[model samples]
Target chain A: MSKYVMKNLSDIEIIESVKRGNTADYTMIVDRYKDRAFNLLKRMLKNDMDAEEALQDSFLKAFRYLNQFREEASFSTWFYRIVYNTALSVIASKKRKIEKEMTSLEDMPELISYDREIYATVENPKDYLMRLIDKLPIKNALVLILYYIDGLSLNEISLVMDISLVNAKVLLHRSRNILRDLLLKHNYQEEIL
Target chain B: MNIDELLNDYIDGSINANKINELKELLEKDEMTAKKLKALKAIDVLMRTIDYEKAPRDFSEKFAAYLAKNRVIKKDRKDFVTPTVLSLFMVVMLCILAVSFYYSYLSINDTEMISGILLDIFNGVSFIAGNKLFHLLGASVSFIALTILYIMNETHRRFRKKIKDL
Candidate 1:
């Protein structure tokens, strides 16, 4: 099928096609989600190879359990849940410490001073901000990517990450403020304006 | 509300008309609020424009190829169906071989073999069917035996699928 027709098919339609033996239709699902999920994994794992592997693992898993899918939940959210959990497993396997979800940030938006060395290497304020987000705590960076990059809402983010809505809001606000503080400190506020 | 909350609502498009004017007044009057607004707007702009890290260019194609290699079209049901069909095919082959071997020992040429074999099989079946009670009992036994075989084969297929999945 043409990419246009494939894109027009709903998730349920694609899934039904897959079940009906047009197995190639599954490529549409993979194409639809791979980049966004890969971006999330890249930030979480901080390694390209690991992120790609985790991305493959998550897709394989979602395909395997496609029958278990319930129609009530949006497929994007369900698939994101798989991608998020797979990234966590990769993190755990690497023995990487997941920054625990703090009940509250007493010193909210407390970020270290912008690294001068990092400032020297990057070209623009956008790249600088990306690096700053990369340096955020895992959950915080995730909340930012989901909301801004993937255009997911705070409620959708909470569902994907298995956190409460309040935690999701806090992570997003805290991460954004942290980036804002870093930008102000580095005199990138003018460029932003 | 604090200026941070107000700025956030403004950024999120949640600030009402009245709140928008209030925020504008706050931003104009306070250097700190003005600076904060600029930074927040910058960060929001940068984040919204952030590029999605491209997965390998052939990612979906590679995954589709992988699915084809694994023959993953409802593979669970296919897994069981395949083995059971192969096993029954083997059994039929064995029966055919045994019948041919018996015919060879009886010195029948190809010309006589077909009718002889058919006659012998017909007589054998008639002898068995001559006893209605025995015929019914044999049919019931065959049904139970086939059901058990199906159940056993299905269970084995599921177990293997689980192992492979893990």
Candidate 2:
């Protein structure tokens, strides 16, 4: 089936088809979630190759154990849990590799390059505000992305990150404060009403 | 509680109307607190406007290939029967073998000594296949049946625990 057609099916129907040995039904799931899962994994792992490999591994594990799924949780939530775990494993594996390599931060290749065009585009007050947000810590970055970019609520972020509601709120508050400080440090003088 | 907590709650929309009124009064009076709130609101807007990087287009295809390979491996590993099923199959096989052997012995043996041995085997097999109460009364099948019963019970218990964990 085409990716669009497969993506349109409900998760429960896909799962039912999977249980009946229709492996192609699972391909639909992979097609629907792969980009989002890979994006999350890439941000968490901070490497393209490792994120890709981990995303593949996670999908395989999820497919192999489809029969064990209990359906008590939403399919996306459950699948994301697997993806999160796989990304964590990839991070741990990379850490081990780095320790073996005995490389310092200075020796590592820079993954994030600052773009002059992006910097120059801050001609408007709103652009300056956005630039400041990009300077937050990775965890804060993820929280901001989920809450703002993905339009998920704090409760949904909590479920995705496996944190409590109070903690999610605290993280969001802290991230906002950090971003505000960054903007002030940059001498952003726009009347932020 | 404090200005910071109130501001945080207010920005997140978790503050009650009473708290909002109190915070509004504070913001009206304190220039620094008001400035902080403004900065925070700006940051919130900034966050809402930022775009994230997208994952590559081939991610799904690669992930599907990996999953297919893993499935093949899992299927190969699953060919072996579970312990419970294996034990049940063994018990059934042994029962059939014993019955066949008994019939064969009766057809071939005619001497009294051999006949006696054959009768003993038949008695033992019958006792093993009989009621638990009969076995408990020291019937010849007592040991064999007890052993099989223990194996079966343990297998069942373990199977139940495994299922529960899953």
True contacts kept of each: 0.78, 0.49
Give the 10-residue window scoring lowest on summed lDDT in candidate 2 chain A.
A98-107
Each model's C-alpha lDDT? 0.82, 0.69
Which digits, one per residue and each the tens of the lDDT, describe model 2 over residues A1-193? 7767676789888989887667767777876777777767666676788877787778887877777777776777677778877876776766733121111123222311232344456777666544533433445656666777766778777887788998887777776665554455444534554
Residues A1-193 of candidate 1 have per-residue lDDT tens digits of: 7878877999999988886667667888998899999999999999999988999899999988886777788899999999999998888888889985432333434445444556778998888878867767788888889999999988899999998987887777767776676677777888766
Kindly report the docking quality category of candidate 1.
acceptable
Backbone clashes in model 2, listed as residue pairs: none
Candidate 1 regions off by >4 Å?
A101-114, B75-166
Could you tell me the lDDT of residue A129 within candidate 2?
47
* i-RMS for every candidate: 2.6, 3.6
Cα error of candidate 2 at position A117, Å: 14
Best by DockQ: 1
